[model samples]
Target: MKELHIVCKVRKKRYRYISQISNKITPNLLKRDFKKDDPNIAWVTDVSEFRFNRKRLYLSVIQDLYNG
Candidate 1:
């Protein structure tokens, strides 16, 4: 192996400024209303996972709020 000489350069420090705004509150539209009057109006979907024999299984379901 042969010896080598290396040169290093220094960089100036940089700073960043961030501005923040106040948060506003929003109202809820559903308000725990799960019932629907007409069909195909509203539908809810959920995903569930289970473990079986060292393997993972996922089940996805979508039900109509009016009928179900």
Candidate 2:
């Protein structure tokens, strides 16, 4: 997270980075097994992740266009 402090004396705002307590959502596993007889579904997603520091983290998302 980041914070922007506004001050009249400075031309630009000050920014502070805040660490997070929990990790973000990331993709860990994937599987696809669908037949032509399957019903129509548009979207699917997977998510898991890891946090490096109070201010840093990695996140990922996996998506499928068709039902599979």
Candidate 3:
């Protein structure tokens, strides 16, 4: 690409507003115990973000520890 004089453009990160920024840490309640005797007694969820083709994609999931 250097021979072709191609250049890639990257966006600069913008400053976040006060409401969007967080300084507190959340406590974990599950303590890494994934096994449960019954459904709905304990639930787990996760969220992930990916960047592809210059676009952002988010995946969110929730599952019961008993059956999952």
Mind giving the per-residue lDDT tens digits that candidate 3 earns over 1-68? Answer: 99999999998988767887689888987888889987898988899989899999999999999999
Which residue pairs in candidate 3 collide?
none
lDDT digits (tens) for residues 1-68 of candidate 2: 13666555655756776676457777543344433343444345555556566555556665445545
Return whichever of 1 and 2 wins on lDDT.
Answer: 1
Worst 10 residues of 2 by lDDT: 29-38
Pairs in clash, predicted candidate 2: 19-54, 26-48
lDDT value, candidate 2, whole model: 0.52
Against the true structure, whose lDDT is highest? 3
Count of steric clashes across candidates, in order:
0, 2, 0
Return model 3's CA RMSD, one decimal: 3.6
Cα lDDT of all candidates, in order? 0.82, 0.52, 0.90
TM-score of each: 0.52, 0.26, 0.58
